[model samples]
Target chain A: MKTRAVILYGLLFLSVFLVLPWIGPESIDPGKIIQFLSGNNTPDGSIFWLQRLPRVILGLLAGGALAVVGAAFQVLFRNPLVEPFTLGVSGGAALGAFIAISIPKLLLTWGPFSTLQVLAVLGASLSLTLIYRLAHRQGGVSIYTLLLAGVTISIMCGGGILLLTYLSSPNALVVFQRWMMGGIDVVGFHELSALFPILLPGIGILFLHANDLNHIALGEEMALGHGVDVKIVQRDVFIGGGLATAAVVSLVGPIGFVGLIVPHAVRRLSGYDQRLVLIGSFFLGGASLAVCDALARTVLAPTELPVGIITALIGGPLFIYLLISRIGK
Target chain B: MNKPIIELRDIYYCYPDSEWELSLSGLAIMPGEVVGIIGPNGSGKSTLLRIAAGVLSPIKGDVYLAGSDLKQMDRRTIARYMGYLPQELISVYDYTVEDIVRMGRYPYIKGFGAFKEPDQRAVIRSLERTDLTEFKHRRLSSLSGGEKKRVFLASVLAQEPDILLLDEPTSALDIHRQVYFFRLLRELASDGLGIGVVTHDLNMASLFSDRLILLLEGKCFRSGTPGEVLDSSVLKKVYGDGLLLNKHPESHRPAVLPRIGPEKSS
Candidate 1:
């Protein structure tokens, strides 16, 4: 069954890769799309390779990261509603980027510190660490406390960012606005390099504990009876899950809906085995984001809608459907 | 034949910093004893069982397993010898019956853990013993309350522990399932496993238990065989008046019958 899910994911990826270049704004001809892949250079092929390829790859990576983080957070909190953004990690990153943009004097004096992406990563990491510490009692983090803390911190950070935006110079405000509306076009090799090491290990840690996470859903007392160290599992899950969310936010701002929607969809298709759910989430997440990114690029033609907007448009209805179905059940 | 498996010495426990305390000055449970602990609510029945199972550390005194202090043993190591089935059986995941039962092997399997052939066999045997083999693949959420209780019992049985500590094992079962479950526990005890159960049903405990420990006001009021502890005087002291204790005509065991209050006497 797991093999079948993987194969299906692979086929989906291949199909999307094949369809994206031809259906985009410039509409690289089918022949050129094929030729570009075969390493043949035509003028039409260069446009496909240069512009669409990076954006598609960025979408796939960001979507997969968000889905995996969402699944991890759901298991960590033992709540189906938990997602990457719910825990203040995304808000912290947004605030960090907002700060970096609003203060040019600070940026000039510390050139390396001026990168919005770096500031976002640092801000998310710090906020998540604080949340973990504050919510933990006797080596365990309660879902209720974690949720409350996350909401409080997120509101505070979000409000701070708004204040900073109001005080910023007009040019800085424009940059901040663009950054807030997350997109896939800005990912460079350097950002990917910095993110790859952290994201890869973080996802690996989650996969390794897939079985343990499944046991945790049985409630903490049962998990402990099964010899699982509940406190240790809780701490490690938060840190690893937080890092994955922070890494993705560092690259594409905060892509919504992929995390919130993908894992729930995968669970409906696959049984509630964390091993299957975790892997399935990655594939479906990547596909969902790729499809959304393609629509974002094509719907407005050259205008390129924000990826966040496309996801929200699709994800909001899906979320409502889930809520209604769950209540019915 | 073997050293007493578990011993408690001068143990004292209280909810943190509270003046009220639950104490067991000295207690020892030997192998193959079916001990039933009965008490009113808040009489420390659950607290004593938790301490014995090593789930809660006593405020003062020592717990020993095989001559070593419980505190000195790793949590997993102690868990290997003790199987605990808490009162609530709420599960987070919708695991299949087999998957839930297989968790019992967790303490036995080593690092890079995979359920081995022995573990599989144990899970199968547990399911069979609990009469749940037919429902092995069913999700826990779909099981009836009695069936769910058996599944949880099967999980503990899969652990293959020397000592089984259960808190209210039959509290919520229908009368038929309660009798069946107590019979199962007696059978397990006969197979040489020590069993300690906390229950409110004194009649059921009297029928099944080899020994009964009656507790009141946070102390053991009487400890003896069921015949010695289930008398009218003990019942009147532990519980209030207006309860009658009589010998069942067929089984010849003690039975409890509720009577009207003295004020209702016309």
Candidate 2:
């Protein structure tokens, strides 16, 4: 089981991780690929650095962070269907992105970050803070109450986005619509630097709590007996998961299914140990999303389909298969 | 003699947003003793065990582990000395027995730490103690009701705690395993660990326990050797009328007889 798991994860990683950045719409020659990568003379130099590699890394970070947080959410809530968006962070970020694109007044850009991205993080933190305040009771955070609060906030955000979508001008509406469709399309090093600060540490915190997450899935009372500080774990994960989700969603509009499916896929491939599940989700989530994003670029060629579209297309069917196979077990 | 390993004093708990009031005035567990907590359903046996194990906080009163107040200590510190087994377990997850047993070592390992030799040895010893050494790699979903219980028991044992608080450890066990479980507790106690077992099986409690504490209506009704506590008249009050009890022929401990007819009305 040990070696088999490693090999399976390795194959998945290599197949997608190796082939994705190179096989875009403008295929870089192997000769040119080396020159551009090694910082030498190449006509396609800016294209490789500015477009392809950043997009690939964006997909990797976005997918890895979402799935990692999604895995953490599943363990924290003890529910299989709970995704990264279960806490309303995506809703908040989506509304922020929508407002930035649609509203004429608030559309401002900062160095290495846009007004939208900052607002998205702010919105996500706001929702998370609200959830934490509402869920805390009797010296404990009730997960059910947190979930209900998240759902309520998500519903409110959804309505707000719909209202803004209706009020925007036709031209701005089109841009907003495309942005809502979601893609891992980054143009330069600024977006990468912006994402790195938030996502890396958030994912690292989740990785540290991997074992504790396993204990939590047993039950809060049971986890406490196992020496987990249930309240602190709850708070840390909410903040960590919220920050990661916000960071990615603000950069590339919310990519669905990676967060929900990767954890289930990893669990099905491996076992229910969160230590393995967390690590596996990161690898498989990044790989799966990278592969899908690759298809989004190549399948449509010059048109450039959104990566989110491909993710749902591939992930929806894959999840169905996983669900059936899991049921069979 | 010396301070008990686990001591509960004046603990009061009423379920949050519920009317159920449960309390424990005082309880103690010393090393090298197996204390059985026996009572009818709804007598708060589970709650008492949870309070003592530091899983549930009491509104009023203090729980001191060894000599220190548990409130001041972190869960990790309390967990090093105490392990709690829940009454009902969900075994649908695809975790290996070894994976679960390995979790018992969590409190000892710092964050981002991997298992070392001592940790692995503790897991192996725990598996052996619960007689699940052969089932280490087996999935929990593949095990039987009784075998799954052993897997959980092995996990708690892997913690290597000085005190164990077990809620209904025997409820899901077969007769042989139930006897085996009691014997295991006896063996562990002899090695100088303390155990508190909550059980409905009066007869099994009588057979293995050094002493028995009978709980009724959220209070300690009686606490004494099995011969003193497991009497027919005492059980009649707790059970409310359907009581037929006698001494075991082999062990000479009290045994409850099956209700032969429609249970005597309360």
Candidate 2 per-residue C-alpha lDDT over A237-309 given as tens digits, one digit per residue, 9 for 90 to 100? 8888988898888888888999999998888768787877888888788887777788888897788899889
Model 1, span A1-329: residue lDDT tens: 35787688778866776667566767567688579788888778776776676667767778887898898788777778888999999989999888888888545323222367678888999889888778876536777888899988899998998899778899998877887778887544434556676678777777767777776777776666666766777777788888888888877888888998899888887777777788888878887898898898889887988888999999999999988997999
DockQ (CA atoms), all models? 0.47, 0.59
Q: Report the C-alpha displacement of residue A319, candidate 1, in angstroms.
A: 2.1
Per-prediction backbone clash count: 3, 0
Tens digit per residue, CA lDDT, model 1, B31-117? 888899998888899889888877678979999976789889875777678778887778766778987888777777754347789
The interface RMSD value for candidate 1 stands at 2.2
Please state the error at residue B69 of candidate 1 in Å.
Answer: 4.2
Q: Candidate 2 at A144: error in angstroms? A: 2.3
> What's the distance in Å from true for residue A283, model 2?
1.9
